[model samples]
Target chain A: MALTGLFLCTFLLVHLIGNLQLFKADGGMAFNVYAVFMTTNPLIKFTSYGLYAIIIFHAFWGLYLVSENKKARPVAYAMVDGKANSQWTSRWMGVLGTIILAFIVMHMAGFWAKYKFGEVPYVQYERNIVDGSMTYGPSAPIESKKEQFVSAETGMEYTIVKDLYTEVAVAFKEWWIVLLYVLAMAAVSFHLVHGFSSAFQTLGVHHSKYNGLIKFVGIWVFGIIVPILFAAMPVYFFIQ
Target chain B: MKITLKVWRQKNTNTSGQFETYKLDHVSEDMSFLEMFDVLNEQLINEGKEPVVFDHDCREGICGMCSMYINGRPHGPKHGVTTCQLHMRSFKDGDIIVVEPWRAAAFPVLKDLSVDRSSFDRIMSAGGFVSVNAGNAQDANNLPIGKEIADEAFMSAACIGCGACVAACKNASAMLFVSAKVSQLALLPQGQPEAKRRAIAMVNQMDAEGFGACTNTGACSAECPKEISLSNIARLNREYLSASFTAQVD
Candidate 1:
């Protein structure tokens, strides 16, 4: 679970970076384009599928362990002391994980689902002939027009290029939404701060000197990058 | 000097605990923190009251038995020292301090300011030992280990099995403790044969003990009386991974 959780944390950095494109000046097209590129790319597609598997496995195993721990200690400790003994994040993994899960679900529903399954109007194009000739004539004028189709059932006009990325920006760029993202990311960072190094230990990869290097990398990858990437999106939009 | 102390008191492991406040007067500044507690206990005995119960042995700080949380910090505001080594001079005459036992699901409190740290012993029992045959002492010159490795092993082995690392961690993780033991042996040739089993058994025991995971916050080392490095935890990780892989391949 720690290994998978740490891996998910690494994925969050890349995911957040791609999500940051929503804050670009170009409404949501830049982010939408980036999203399209990500979803359609074969390598990214494989990684995304892997990410889904990791999340499920991590969450399920984490839940299993938590329940097992709870069962181990049916009663609370008597001393009720030692608040200084452990890291804040270590004690609060379950809470942080739940928050991250909530945010992820909302995120997927708002952007991913919309882009994949939401109905959109098809693009229409028109070409005009010049000088009543099949081919273009000298000094002949040519005309071109574009149109959008509206849904007959819903009576709503929607563009095929509906910027789902723009919708995400509108939702997440709000102060509260951005704050939620930041808070969730902070929890993620804390979770990673411990999870990353601990995963290697649990997996039994101790090597004295190199272990220190791996821990340093864990801090950089999880503690720094995850929060920064998630924070970037809100900052990008809020700055302007 | 007089100081106010709010010490955690609980009837037993099954009962809820609370901070019971007590005051000590004319405590000597030169006296150690435990000495201050001695004064309080003396007063309690004189008053026909049950004195606070806490763990301490080799009050000189060699034994990791002296564990407590003082004023939201381990070892009562002093850095790099055990609870027994903390002196009253670090506080003012009228300071109000809060004292508590190590809080974790794994380390249950036995009574007032005392917790059962046998979980640590269990973890050690799982994988902390070397598999050496029973025989007479070998000649010192028989096995020639380099000075550097020997020194490193000694440093790692210096950990006194104190639960301070667990208390100092926000998650109450025993990573530092487990790492220290694992690294101490893994560094030496004597511990090579059972290194794989040791790593797996120790980690499994740690998990079984319900200790929280390490978060690489470095808090454990900071609060460790011996100042055991966080690098030990890393070494434990590497050892566990390599051992598990080797075991799988075999």
Candidate 2:
């Protein structure tokens, strides 16, 4: 669970960084192009499969651990105060994990599935070579899903691809969708606050010399920065 | 002080238990928690009733014999003290105190408020000791240890084998206890010869005992009477991992 959890944490950073393209001023061109690259690149495509498996495995293994823990103490304490010693996030990892799992499914259904198999509108971006000015609109009817062309007449480069950016925009247009993503990111924040450092401890990596660094990266980087940045994408689109 | 006590009453390990509440009046605020229990037992005996069963040897904290889940905490609400060391002054008049035995499959209740912590004994036997050559008092002076190392080892050794950590853990994990033993021995040169094997053997026994795995919740340390540090658990993990990966032991 620790190794797999760290793997997922690394993936979160990569995913968050890649998705930061959404914040670019380009009309989703960079994000859509980046999305296409992510799905089509053989190495990343292969890694995505492993990522999916790891996510599922992490969730199930976590639940199994929970069951084993429960079995260890079959009879619950009649009047125990759980809050006395432990942090709430540390104790509710399973519940928070379950929420993140559900959120993953919902998130994939909304964007990933749509980009892969659903009806995503296509767009064409035309950029002038001289001025670096760009124009994008619905692609002229074409059989190819994605194509890049340089115009001979006006020295313009045109790139046409599936408008996953539009798909993102359309999805985030709904207040509920934005709310769900924000809430899921909050769950992600809570999950990592305990999970990041806990993983290191389980991996036998705890030491006083490095404990502070581990905790700082765990809480500030994974728990705060990563989730906030990922969350900002959807909210940015919603409010835009 | 007048206090209501809700004590768990169980006939045996195979039998189920229920909460039996008894009202104790004129309880002295100066009395220890166990002494308060003694008062309740005396009252029960006078009324021609069976006295409550509990585990206690030395009336001091060093015995580690007394085990109770008082008001949801392993050793009552006070920190850094066993139930025997807990005073009734920590509570107020008309307070309801709930007391029960350690709840873990590994530590089954022998009767009301007394659990069989023999599993801990088994774990101790597994790898908690070092095989040292029998020698005279010169043995103590022969091996020298750094003060810092000795202090750390002593901190780990302070674990009294009171099953409070297990009782306090949500997972009933014995990580703190096992790690404390492992950490203490591994810190000393005398224990270095078998440290690898000891780590593996003790961890195997811990797993065999059906204690839950550590989730790093910090409850075990927080509720520990001796305040055993969680760093010992980290060292246990490191030692166990090193053993499993590199140890030559079978």
Candidate 3:
């Protein structure tokens, strides 16, 4: 469970870095090309399968831990000072995890499924060449896709990709979508705050000399920085 | 001084339990909490009624036998002291003190405030010892343990196996107790040979004993009579992780 969880943690950082391309001034071309490259790259494609397996493994393993923990305390204390001992996030990891799970479902349904199998709208780009003009369409087959091509009309090379930036902008334009995204990011932040250092602790990588550093990074980096970057997306799009 | 007591009473492990109140008049400020209880019991005996039962030994506080939750805090409001050491002066006249046993699935009420802590014994037996062949004892000088390390180990060794940590924990986790034993040995050279085995075996026993996982709750240390540090638990995590990964390789 620890290994899978940490693996997913690494995945989150990489995913965030790639997704940040959406903020580029280019009309979704950078984000869309990055998305296409991620989906079509053989290595990334294989990693995606592993990612799916790891998520299921991590979630199920967590359920097992939660159930076992529940059974360990068959009867509840009548007067418990829950805040006296631990952080609220540490105590409510299961609930926060469940929230994140729901968020993942909504995310995949809205974005991933649409890109992979659902009928998403397409964009067209026209380029001039010395001899002839060229027209590009996103609705073309995957095998026929090109990063950049020379136009016959002007003999100038132009790069074209899908308009995922526009797609995200359109989605975030709705108040409800922006609100849900922000709320889900909050859940993700809480989950990561407890889970980040906890993963290392569970895996037995802790030491007196460096344990504090691990916790510090977990709190400031994964807990605060990652979630802020993620949450900024919807807010940025909605306002813009 | 006069004080009101709300104490948990149970006939046996299988029977349901409830709070039974008793008022004590002429309670002396100098009397220990248990002595106050003794006063109440003596009064009950004079009245030809069954007295409230609680576990206690070595009232000076070394023994972990005394277990009680006073007003929602384990071992009463006193810091770094057991229930036996809690002085009645800590309470005011007409104060209501609610006493109860350690409430955990692993710890069932055997009577009015005494709990069956034998599950802790089981976890201890699982891996809380070093395997030394019976023979003449080795020279103490030969071990050559560093003083800093020895001090840390002794601090962990001070754990009385009291379930204050478990009681204080929301999850009823025995991580503090088990970690104390594990870290005590893991820090010493004499405990190296079976360190991995001890880590894995003891943790597995802890799981089987129905103790919950540690969620880094600082309550165990805060409420500890011995003030055992939470660093021991971090060491336990490190030990368990190392042992698990290398178990099959061995």
Candidate 4:
């Protein structure tokens, strides 16, 4: 569970980096190009399969651990001040994880699945000319060649490209969607607060000298900083 | 002082338990928690009723036989003290004190507040002792253990085999108890020979005993009568991982 959780943590950072491209002021050209690159890159595509497997395994393993824990105490105490014994997040990791799992399902369905299979509307950026040959559009120049161009795949003169950036922007423009993203990111933060250093301890990397430092980073950096940055993305787009 | 007691009462291992409340007046402030229970038991005995049954060996806090969860804490609200050592001064007049047995599947209540703690003994017996042969006491200087290492080991060794760590755990995990024993042995030169075997054996026993995995909550240490550090749990993790990797050669 620890190894898989850490793997997911790394993936979060990479995903955050990719998503940050949406904030660029290039009329969605750069962001869409990056999104296409992420989807098409063979290496990333293969790793994405592994990522999916890890996420599912992490969730199930967590479920198994929690079920076994529940069995450890068959009789419930009449009065329990659980806060006296442990942190709220430590006790409710399963609940937070389930929330994140639900969020992941909705998130992928809303964005990833739509980008892949849903009918995403398209925009036509002006094609550029460099060195006497037609090249991809540039951010600064907004001119398209007047000559009619035919596409083999659709068999039509392509007037537009897939406008995934606008899809994201439109989604964020709704206050409810942004609210959901913020709430889900809050769950992610709580999950990481326990999971970050917990994975190291589970994998037996707890050094006498470095253990405290690891926990510090787990609670402070991963728990606080990463979640804030992630939540900020939607808020940034909503205002924009 | 006047106080209200909500103590768990169970007939036997086969019967379900419930709380029975008893109000007491003129309670002394200096009376230990156990003494207050004794007063209650005296009242029950005077009324020709079966008194509450609980476990206690060395009331001064050394022998970890005492098991009770008072007011949502393993050993009442006091830190670094057993239930027997806790004084009534910690409570106020007209206080409501709720006490129960250690709640764990592995620790079924035999009767009243007494639960079976043989699960701890089983885990301990799996590998808690060194294999040194019987002989006259060796010279104290022979070990040559550094002061820091000796202090660390002694701290871990202070674990009195109490079930408070287990009771205090949300998952009913025995990690603190098991880890304290492991950490004590893992730190000493006498315990080095069988270190790998001991780690694996004890941890496997802990798992088989239906204890939950440690999620590093630090509650055990907080409520520990001995105040055993959570670092011991970390050391146990390290030791177990090391043993699993090198067990083939051993």
Highest-scoring model, TM-score: 2
- In candidate 4, what are the lDDT values of residues A184-227, reduced to their tens digit? 99999988998898788777676779978988888887899889
lDDT of 3 by residue, B178-217 (tens): 9999999899877888899999999999888888887664
True contacts kept of 1: 0.30
Clashing pairs in 4: A123-A161
Chain B TM-score (each prediction, in order): 0.96, 0.97, 0.96, 0.97
Q: Which of the two candidates, 2 or 3, achieves a greater lDDT against the reference? A: 2
Order the numbered candidates by TM-score, best leading. Answer: 2, 4, 3, 1
- Candidate 3 docks at the CAPRI level of acceptable
Q: Give the candidates in order of lDDT, highest first.
A: 2, 4, 3, 1
**Can you list each candidate's DockQ?**
0.21, 0.81, 0.42, 0.59
The interface RMSD value for candidate 1 stands at 5.0
Instruction: Estimate TM-scores for all models.
Output: 0.76, 0.97, 0.90, 0.92
Docking class of 2: high
Candidate 4 lDDT, B74-186, residue by residue in tens: 99998999999999999999999999999998898999999999999999899998888736767999769899998999999999987999998889999999989998988
Ranking according to DockQ, highest score first = 2, 4, 3, 1
Q: DockQ winner among the candidates?
A: 2
lDDT of 1 by residue, B107-129 (tens): 88899888899998899889798
Report the Cα RMSD per candidate. 7.6, 1.4, 3.4, 4.7
How does residue B51 of candidate 2 score in lDDT?
Answer: 96
